[model samples]
Target: MASTDDNGVAGYDILRAPGASGGTFTQVGTSTTTSFSDTGLTPSTTYRYQVRARDAAGNTSPVSNTAELTTQPGPSSGTCTTVPTVQTQWGTGYVIQPLTITNTGTSTITGWTATFTLPAGHTLSGSWNGTATVSGQTVTIRNVSHNGTLAPGASTTSVGFQATRPNGNTALPSGYTCA
Candidate 1:
């Protein structure tokens, strides 16, 4: 929360693992403040979280203590779907496709995620408009502060990324599921 030049933390990075074990940890997001609430989590499921601090100059500290979260059980209040559109393509690397997320539920939704499997030889590098992270071949895209909320009735938002692809395989990612 405090920002200073002397051993000061400029931001924080939070990571999560499904349930308490077995699943690997993945970077969920980076926040300029101290407190963060991870979004796009399953209802009535357990999650493990760890955070690290980053300085103004981009130096990151070691992982902090781990915490667990168990969301309350309920019929999830919202529905969403994502369609990946090719934004650009080139040799070896292509600008990450923009994923369009549409809100189909009746109520207003606060946050969402677009999960997909990276194609063979494609690797995620960075993104804009949300947090983009890859674990193995699975890519998880989560909402940042500004673009999280969506009104009902086909409200749509998008996130884009940068990745490398096979020279001939400039195709976009497939099998995207919104949550």
Candidate 2:
């Protein structure tokens, strides 16, 4: 799309929502041509996108229609791993000792997230050092700004959470995956 021939159209600005539900859009890139490519995004995560034409004078046209896509899942092997330790427990509640995030790859990592599923009847009561989200039995934990970014062979033990489960249940979480 073009605006009045102020300088003609020079490029397009690309915007993306941080999540799948289109919460909000922020400029993620600029493309001088008709196409753009975004890289280094998290795998299996949904994103919403929009583009607007820009003039040489830096004026922008109305945003184009929204486009949404979900990236394919990353490979099973990643640069990092998250391990939880049990600190304490009671009849119906337990504290997961701080989680340790370790970078096993050769390069520094900007951020990381871990996913796992709790046993039936378990619910997260709270967390620290990381943001936690629970859906049914699945939990997703993401590094906070201050704790992210790790160099090769580095490790951080700042993430943890507490949860409640059925009294006397001995089951623990399984299927841990971090990337």
Off by over 4 Å in 1: 1-76, 154-158
Estimated TM-score for each candidate: 0.56, 0.59
Tens-place lDDT per residue, model 2, 1-179, is 54666588888899999776748899999999998999999999999999998998777899988898999966534399888898988889888877889988888887888898999999999999999999889999988998888888888898889989999997878888889
The root-mean-square deviation over C-alpha atoms between each candidate and the true structure, in angstroms, is 15.5, 11.2
Model 1 scores worst on lDDT over the 10 consecutive residues at 1-10
Tens-digit lDDT track of model 1 for 13-127: 9999998777998999999988887777788899998898888877787888888889986543788888877777788887755678888898877888889888888998788
TM-score result, candidate 2: 0.59
- Report lDDT (Cα) of residue 84, candidate 2: 83
Q: On a 0 to 1 TM-score scale, where does candidate 1 land against the true structure?
A: 0.56
Task: State model 2's lDDT.
Answer: 0.87
Tell me the whole-model lDDT of each prediction, alpha carbons only. 0.80, 0.87
Best candidate (score: TM-score): 2
Which candidate leads the pack in lDDT? 2
